[model samples]
Target: MKYLIPLLFAASPVLADAPVVENITYSDGRFDVTLSHGDTGWDDYADGWRVELADGTVLGTRVLAHPHVNEQPFTRSSQIMVPDGVTQVFIRASDNVGGWADDTVPFSPN
Candidate 1:
């Protein structure tokens, strides 16, 4: 049953710690935000991710109606309209099965 043991371990789900906003870039009338997480596999739960602006304003949130099977680093790029006079942005994530987590990154508009 040694093989069974390994199989079971592999089948177990890996819970991602949380997601964070690593950086924000503003150029050419576009806003590009990057996200990083302890587990890149969290893309499977991308629907639970969200982006919010300072002062509790939500910019955009994940809308993953279906599970994402991306096999890359734990990062995502989004194109957004640079909010007027926005100084900072917040990134939030949730697992539908639990509460939410968020991180804030400061940036300057072009």
Candidate 2:
């Protein structure tokens, strides 16, 4: 009975807090994505974001250089070479600790 509580406590750090994509905007082949996270410091922050197709083909990525500690929600843009005939794509956000979030934003390049 005592073994379970200690194990859960030890494994608690593995439960990652993923960053959230607040909004996504596309214009003239550029994607501006906004993300919000509980960025305490360099140890935990929203690291990067990407533009990709529905099939998981990454079109472009922006690696956020530093921690936005004071800035709660920030916006960044990237230019992706969205191929022809691809009318829609997905915007995904990531954290420095968790890698990537399963949440995807469906966007139309219209």
RMSD of each: 6.5, 1.7
Cα-based lDDT at residue 65, candidate 2: 89
Candidate 2 has which clashing residue pairs, if any? none
- TM-score of model number 2: 0.88
> How would you encode candidate 1's per-residue C-alpha lDDT over 1-110 as one tens digit per residue?
76999999899876665545566565664555455443334443444555576677777665434333452223444556657776566656654333376445556654
| lDDT (C-alpha, whole model) for all candidates | 0.54, 0.87
At residue 97, candidate 2 shows an lDDT of 89
Error of 2 at 81 (Å): 2.5
Q: lDDT by residue for model 2 over 12-102, one digit each (tens)?
A: 8765688888888888878888899988899989999988899999988999988998987899888876898998988888888888888
Cα lDDT of candidate 2 equals: 0.87
Indicate which candidate wins on lDDT.
Answer: 2
Best by TM-score: 2
